[model samples]
Target: MRAIKFNILLILIILNFSAIAQIKVTSNTFYFGTIINIEKFAGKDYRYSLELKSTETDSLKKIVIQTRQVINKDKMLDANATKDSVKDTLWHQINVSNKINLKAKEMWLYATFEGNGNFFADNLKFEVKTEDGNWKEVPIKNADFEKHDKNPLKGFLTSAKIPDGTTISLQPRTDAVKGKALLIKSTKAAIIWKTNYGSNRRTGKYCNVNGIKIYYEIYGTGEPLLLLHGNGQSIVDFTKQIPTLAKHYQVIAVDSRAQGKSIDNKSNKLSYDIFAADMKVLLDSLHLKKVNILGWSDGGNTALIMAIKYPEYVGKLIVMGANLNPTENAVEKSMLNQLKKDFKMLQLKEDAESMQMARLLLMLSTEPNIKVEDLHKVNSKTLVLAGEKDVIKAEHTKLIASNIPQSELIIFKRETHMIPNENASLFNQTVLDFLNEADVKHP
Candidate 1:
């Protein structure tokens, strides 16, 4: 019976694999596109065609079909649409032609609209012009929206945006040019990168701190809560936490020096102490005397240093996956070993980019030599957290927690260092609950 079930499962997998094709993109923005690998079609002429329909029928409006070919370092071919097509509700077949770059690795096909309205696309096709003058149909995965599953728009590459009245999905329509069509609707103008936390210019600002520029974004209104991301990461690492946390607190999400949009002097050696000092200067510049801080990984190490070295600036502290030292005893042996390997490789490369990365890796493997006795000096209420399978050893996390006068420790069962991203809701709520916990009553 087990053999029979296995056979059936294999057959289903084969069927699904062969039936893969098509994509749907839903956005309030004017454009949506998909990248196609055209390495085999290099130096060839090709035409891409698709059926388009829009609920908006203003005669002045048009839907432009465009193709762009990308090679190693440049866009070799670009074709723009000037025709005033897609002016009605009826399905209109549209096509655009372009020559693929001789060394092209990929091509982008896009549909751009001039005005706001509901949109539908179907019967997508791509053809390469043969040397003998024949148009050969290329196999496009699920070119028609015939699949009905949870992820119907699997092949379309679209960035995530806040659900601001825009939605895209596959729907069966009797009027569809084929079996089904992709429906895109919007009732509001699209705000690009609403959750693009780190790099969003609207919320981002920079300040000179200790000869380096630190980038940060502010959100919501209330008690200030500063968020610091792990090493080699940016403010975007807290993308899931910001929206929810911002509702209750003034979220001050910052990209640490040398990371994200923050710029650092290439000559300076990085350390958690340096990171902590950078935060101090930034907070001073913002005129925030005391604020709650939540940090992960290297950010967590910085948070610990802040609580120890500058207690006056901290109201509450939370740190996850932080260690007191860069040793096998503090971090899991495998990760420490891997860091050493990476650091060694980076040291051999003298290029500016390589040296910068090497410095970060070296710091990760050889610094943050915090003394356990220093933990006793932390005055702020603290929350020490780590995953059961975290790179930071469970014992080291307990050592840090036990030394602090008013501290709590939590070990997430069966979790790893990436719990912040893997189980963001739970992590966000945990941080909120800790920050919201009322102060202990005093006699």
Candidate 2:
């Protein structure tokens, strides 16, 4: 182990993996997430964090590296060697090649060791080179996926045993931003993490609902709450919302027929009404007469239909980004354009995923024809919601609310179609407020 100096332009970050050489770097510009230089070193495994301190004692902040990727593209033996020239190179740069946001203007970046992660720097010198990115200017595009000399990023790598609901992130940018971003690799080497609910993990038995095997999950113990995800999405979509809601209620999230873990044997053609009927049967199998329902996007359409057709099964209805009709007024112009673009992209590829996505998108163009009068028949207390910039038009969402007698409507400000994912806090609170405080009057 050799002793080294701490240097990063003007500001210095000193790390000590005892008996190992000091961590040194040539550049300080960080290149954000666009480039990650993982230099081979004669050092032990370490938890690293770059901390920024302010004049105030309580204002210190740090960015810790959560996920470390090791790529062996050519299956070279040198990569496995303990200490070799190629193995322990001066620096083997692994360019991130992904966009990472950096907010601080001028601050000291100090690399912290395990115990020293919380150390506050009093007056550490610092400098900003303003190198936003050089990787973006490179000739190669998506160098992570397609092998190219022009780009240095091999690809995203992850641990094999990432547990369920355990989101293995590269870094938690901010306290607020932590666990929000997920790395979905374009290629096969994706970060696959599932939520590990040891005792809570139960086998998803198939319910012969409408002859389609509807896969459902029941977590927690209380009043039943059926959670339905968006079009083409499965139970994974409700990953964030489930944990919180499950604590108070018996959360039943299902992988819709032909989506997620659910097998679809009943349909070649699909409609919201067809799906609504499936839900009614699933509830009957569980012997649940009435349950609270929350649905997003296409799931919302199904929920609306369920409440209208089988009012006995649904206690309260919460629908987001749902439309009564697949008309120009109901759907956004930009959404329609994006759908066309998606089809064009998938038309070139005949893969299962492409085919599946294309099929779902095609269904969005038609089906879901809930008449204005149909909403009046919905006996359950309904809460119609949509994002400010939702794929479904604002007028369309309000129209549903208007048609349903005594129903409430809410449009989340500055939010998109995936409000649950975008502004989860507000979305979750909105849901709990509606379901929990049923006795409280709405404004």
Candidate 3:
């Protein structure tokens, strides 16, 4: 019995030691836009200064640093995340070496401490090397990352003054080393939250045109570039394109009449002609005689109408997923059928949004009868775009492109009807390329 007791005590001691061997790492709530001072660095080119302090320096554990674009996570920053050995609690200030290639609003810097140990990092910051050989701080809030569990990320990184029609949520992650990072999700933040730099100088206003109130957002400064969204969609569809396009041009993203937050004004029917006329008046209201236009789906239909009717007003025309007609050959029957079902489903519900969706779908079903002869009337240079898996038939897109005297056709691979939203960077680049190309007058 004494021998048995000794064996049990030895086992208990071993279990206690194993439990104590586990790693215990805790950190503060992540700081957003923490701007680090640049003067501390030797050269003009500045980088992140991570001041990490460990409780007990372990030979096996190390901290790895990385920076990546939040929008395009695939592209790694030039200043790659390097793992630094933790020989002591305070050895040397980690210099994330290299000038940030992109602008301040482009990237997010992150650090991960690996292995079994407790690590502490404070005075974490990121600085940008300016064009005039000056270093600028990219302001970060809750900088030290000391507010975890007590105040989780879900309700954190927010304020009492959140923009209307938007909500921020958090997605839990287990693989996040040291519980270091959290994925902040702003479900419908496009209307208000534009960019990370808080540089959304996008101004919004309402204009009374064509017997309805049209809502529009004007971004950046340059030659006016009008952006139009798709069917059952609003200016929010161009959320991805606006930031990039605004960089080069004065982007004017508009919500079509009766769509989004715009007032319908009890119009008898919805048609592309009405939409075109309304947009024409918006231009007149803004006193814009000529402007470049980018359109997708139903908006494409309206742009073509404007180009054909008011040729003098259009500078450059870009149309994606627009159909001349919704026949079986032009638009697949299944697509039309699905639209009809959706419209009916909405209608049967007898809701405020029901009639709006139904009318829009009705417009899709019966409108946009742009004959090849009509296409010839548009004198503006055009870019005809379609997706590989678009609801609009390839032949129809080809027909539209072939009809236009000076038009470039581009069918994006692995893309569908929602090219503007799905493949925004590519679409924006293509449009920008076409817009910036040497102007060639179409006969």
lDDT of 1: 0.75
Error of 3 at 14 (Å): 48
Worst 10 residues of 1 by lDDT: 17-26
* Best model number under lDDT: 1
TM-score-based ranking? 1, 2, 3
Task: Tell me the number of clashing residue pairs for each predicted model.
Answer: 4, 5, 10
Where does candidate 1 stray beyond 4 Å? 1-51, 56-87, 90-118, 123-141, 148-178, 183-206, 217-223, 236-250, 286-290, 325-358, 365-367, 371-376, 386-405, 411-425, 438-443
RMSD of 1: 10.3
Task: Give the lDDT of residue 204 in candidate 1.
Answer: 79
TM-score of 2: 0.59
Per-residue lDDT tens digits for candidate 1, residues 1-443, read 22222222222221222211211222343445566788998888888888888895443345666666765221234444536667668878898887777878877666655335677888778889999999998877767867755655677544334246657778776662347788766565432323455656566789898668899999999999999899788876787799999999999999998887787757778899989999999999989967999989999999999999999999899999998998878888888887777777767767766677777888888789999999999999898888888889999999989998999898888888988876787787888888889442211
RMSD (CA, Å), each prediction: 10.3, 15.5, 21.7
Candidate 2 wrongly placed segments (more than 4 Å): 1-32, 35-203, 265-267, 344-349, 438-443
What value does the lDDT take at residue 7 in candidate 2? Answer: 24
* Cα lDDT listed for each candidate: 0.75, 0.56, 0.65
Per-residue lDDT over 1-443 for candidate 2, one digit per residue giving the tens place of the 0 to 100 score: 00111121112112221222122322111112212333322121222222232111121122222212222110111111011111221112211111122321111122221111122111111111224422222122232222323322223222212323222222222443233222211111222223532112343456877567787778888999999888877776785798789988898888876677666643267677778888888898899978999999999998998988998999988998999877889998877787777766766766565566666676777768888998899988888899888889998898899999968889988888877965787888888888986543332
